[model samples]
Target chain A: MLILNVILVIFLIICAVAVERTKDLLGAVIIFAAYSLIMAVLWLMLQAPDIALTEAAIGAGVTTILFIGVISRTRRMEK
Target chain B: MDDIIVKTITRLIVPFIQVYGIFVILHGHISPGGGFSGGAVLGSSMILFTLSFGLPMASRKIPHKVTSILETSGILWYIIIGLAGIYLGGKFLVNKEAGFFMGQAGELISAGIIPLLTLGIGIKVASTMITLFHTIIEED
Candidate 1:
């Protein structure tokens, strides 16, 4: 359990940095979605199922769609 | 976007997502999930549909006007229910003192006004998500 938590946290840090470092807006959004998924799973492990559910639905689901829509309206590659 | 396989899979899966969302909303009082989470789940299903089919078809199914009405009515319903407590000579949003029926613990029909409030919140949140997504997507 501790090892799993450590691995998730490490992945989360990597995703956070990669989202910022990525030059492509769409790739950043996708990475952010991955970050959210990992955070949701961590929330579940922490016994806050409600937060986990919200994180998955809003973070992984709707936010990704919204971000993609914005990217379509503007540009996919960051300046 | 125009793939037959994507459309077929979306059609097959959306119903289950919606059912699970409703289940989460309805069982909120006795379970881990509540209005916001369930409503997000419900709204995401519609979003998935929009992604699979085009925006035109999705908008036809859940029009902007319908979502607007739903958003307004959800809050209106919540306010009406809350005011019922005052009408019954108690504090605003009071449950037991408001004469609401509280059933057994962990039952579906228990929790008095909480379930009703959750329903209102669920409706509001779901409509809000749909409206926001539609507006963002449709902007020129």
Candidate 2:
């Protein structure tokens, strides 16, 4: 479990950096969704299933859809 | 966006996701998931349908007016349930002490007003997600 947690933390950091550095708004949004999914997993590992479920729904699910919609409406590539 | 595989898979899985969401909400008092999480799952399934089938077809399944009604009704349901407590000679939202049928501890129908409240919350949350998605996707 400790090793898994470590790996997940590393993956989360990578996703956050990728989201920050990516030039494409869509790609950044996708990465942000991935980061949320990993955070959900971390929450589950900590035995907070309720928080995990909420994170999965709001973070990875609804937020991702909203971001994608905004991207489609406004601009795909950052200036 | 309309890949045949995506459409087919979404059609196959949406029902299961919805059922699981309902199960979670119903068993909230006895289980890990509750109204908020279960409603989110249900809402996500709807959003997934929108993504796979496009806004037109998804809107046909649940139109704007219907979602509006649902959002309002969920809160009304909660208020009505709370009012039931007053009618029963107790404070708002009282449950077991107010003559509700509190079955066995872990039974599906146990927990009196909890399941009812969960249902209302689930409905409200699901509609909120749908409405937000539609509004964001709509015209600037």
**What TM-score would candidate 1 get against the native?**
0.96
User: Per-prediction TM-score, please?
Assistant: 0.96, 0.92
State the displacement of the C-alpha of residue A76, model 1, in Å, after optimal TM-score superposition. 2.1
The alpha-carbon interface RMSD of model 1 comes to 0.6
Candidate 2 lDDT, tens digit per residue, B24-125? 888899989899999999999999999899888988999999999999999999999999988894789988779998889998988889999999999999
User: iRMS for all predictions?
Assistant: 0.6, 0.9
Stretches off by above 4 angstroms in model 2 are none
Tell how far residue B97 is off in model 2, in angstroms. 2.5
How well does model 1 score by local distance difference test?
0.93
Give the clashing residue pairs of candidate 2, or none: none
Q: Enumerate residue pairs that collide in model 1.
A: none
